[model samples]
Target: MAPSPSSAAQHRHHSSLPTVSSAVSWLFLSLLFLYVVYYSTILFEPAPTFTTTTTTKTATDCQDISTIESNTTRVLRFDTELRHIAFGIAASSRLWRIRKEYLKLWWRRGETRGAVWLDKEVTTTENENLPDIHLSEDTSKFSYTNPNGDRSAIRISRVVSETLRLGMEDVRWFVMGDDDTIFIVENLVRILSKYDHNQFYYIGMTSESHFQNMLFSYGMAFGGGGFAISYPLAVELERMQDRCLQRYPGYYGSDDRMHACMAELNVPLTKEPGFHQNDVHGNLLGLLVAHPVTPLVSLHHLDVVDPIFPGMPRVQSIKHLLESAKYDSASIIQQSICYDKKREWSILVSYGFAIQIVRGILSPRELESPARTFLNWHKRLDYTAYAFNTRPVTRNPCQKPFVYYMSSTEYDKTREKIIGIYTLHRERYPYCKWKMESPEDIDTIVVLKKEDSSRWTKAPRKDCCRVLPATKNGTLYLWIGNCQTNEVIEL
Candidate 1:
């Protein structure tokens, strides 16, 4: 089998031919596969299907969703200056505290584009940071006094006329407010957008205090809460303000005089619920939580209302609350009324602030609920006392719940008791109750004892009270049995 070298070489070459052919075939196949893949990806691949489902919604759900959609869409994109809104701030020299704390913030924000009407010119080194100051003395010559000697009427009437005259040529809207008033500028603009600026419009809301509303005309907007006047209306007011002031000599306040003037103009007051003149004193939890479905345009009497958050000053609290609205405008504007029929509990939610729980029977009238005193964060108590009333129960109030906390004076006295109550029953009873002993004092503490337990154990301060012993239908029946009578009253 010993062959020559040339023949052996020829045989080795013949054997390598098959291996070369095999490599070539594999390379050709890989190239074909790559070509097919490339073509498939580029030209033959299926287009992505974007299938949108049409949800079958209930009547209530449809309404809510529609309202939300409308609100979201209504947010317009425009420059703030395009509105030509001017602020007419009625300020006194004696209210230095307000001028320093609140006015400074407004000035820094640079939203107020008008002047502060003062009794005398303020010559200060910090004048650069302040809004325009128009001295009352300069405008007083044209002013008319009330025959009944109402100084506020005389001053406000003059100021209104002066502000209108000052802003008539340059501004489209003239906004009037007291020194203490705080305005949500964006919200105000949006609110203004709803109505035509060219037309005569007088926009405002009723006072928070029922008594004040009764004393003054409910039809008239509270000046402290702020009001907006269209250019045409302001011009009309400027022409007739002096005459109206002479006619309404018996009017008690500036608001009444303005109302009388508007009535004479045959222009009806347009109510806007967002402008809150916090005329009521005590915790604003009930009123705020049950706020009407609208944007909160302004909050007056910050001094009267408790701090919006805990461990913070009133000014800081207000600033924080206003800032919160920027993050969730839709939530702030939308109706936040929620109810749970099964538990017989009605929940009122004020976005980024407070929640109120009341009996379902008191659904719409949540403000009048016996459990209205169960404010979660009106005051900074213990972490255990603060309950997260926001739906879906995400976290404990102690764990940085999505709400503003304000300082409360009663935190020290109630902290230990609330903590102990939460620690003892948190595992067994998820719900907590706060039964207010005295209606006048919102800070008054009441200890709720468990139905079965004989010991008088304090209940968690926030989200207090639970419905007991669920029925087959999942309806909770609370029985009220009097000691003197054998009959049991069930609710």
Candidate 2:
């Protein structure tokens, strides 16, 4: 009585198909619900918020015009010297070219009265119109063959005594130098003015070469660079000349013998930064480019240094360059080099007379980084204080923007508590505003802003910046800030 087996099987298969479809639909709906819940939880979570607050601070009015006026007057007073300056030269044919180039300029200056002390008689034809000439044989009995095989020591050692005996009664400073030495007269006058002419001051700087300085007394002023003996000192030296020469008979160099005599007289060397005994031989562009803050007095051994300009004769060109710079010493000292491919430098003459090697060859990233400090120039008068106080922050700027910083040592605590900032390159930015903030106990933050961002980037930045007067043309007035004692800290 049951239906066929095939019909029963077909009915069962149709019923199973409906159950499988319903199960698949439920699984898909469950997965969709979980995905929706996960996404909704993420979307509903709190969003992070960032806030940047801009601080607006008023620029402090700190510049005092009267103080600057007084300082200028002081500088003017320091520039003049009442004493007569006399040049005593140790002459030799070996340095005839130097004599021709340097003496000619000295003659033209008319500020210096000069005389050449020679080992033998030299004619005008051979010596090139050099002023007064005296034979060394006629001067002093001190004579010895130096290990260096040069008679310069004997000539230099005796010249001082001979110059005084020759009736230089009116001469206040007897400057003894070799034929190769070139002196800046104005700078010499300014430097000598610092000391009393009546007192016996041996004003000279030590040798630039470490080896030479070590071999001889580091305290001794190398005579080739030239040294000045005050009238009073010269008188004492004259009295002890023969006696001192006999004492140091084995001494070959004039400087060592002079040192011995000075030691006996209890006259310590009064070192002046301007007098340079340049012993190194190479391109001197680095030396002259970053010249010290102090005035340049003299340059010795010119034959070794390269020419100042390209394609020009060394001696004549250097003399002309010096002559031009002599009139405007400030301009020469404050000179900043930006980009000179021919000269092989990018930015020359930084805060420490440092050279920045930024030729076209360097990448932008390399140029952006801080410059390497080249201390080819001599140590600053106060190396420790200078290094600690005037450390730089950025190297992007070539020339220093702020020339002056208020020194806690200079001003009294009761004096108007304002920091002074002076700018040398005012042509780039006429006005600048600065904000000072101290975060850490040791660090002080200074932010400088000008209307023109492009120009602001050129000015140099330092921790404790150098403070120089705005004497150059187009220089701007000083900027004063109400920075507290707590704000100024050691780096």
lDDT per residue for candidate 1 within 191-249, as digits (tens), equals 67667777899999876444556667779988888898888888898898877777755
Clashing pairs in 2: 404-467
Most lDDT-accurate candidate: 1
Instruction: Name the regions of candidate 1 deviating beyond 4 angstroms.
Output: 1-83, 107-111, 127-129, 137-150, 167-170, 333-348, 355-491
- lDDT of model 2 at position 490: 21
Candidate number with greatest TM-score: 1
Report model 1's TM-score to 2 decimal places: 0.56
- Looking at model 1, report the run of 10 residues with the lowest lDDT sum: 417-426
Error of 2 at 427 (Å): 29
Tens digit per residue, CA lDDT, model 2, 50-84: 55333332321111101122122112222224237
lDDT of candidate model 2 versus the reference:
0.53
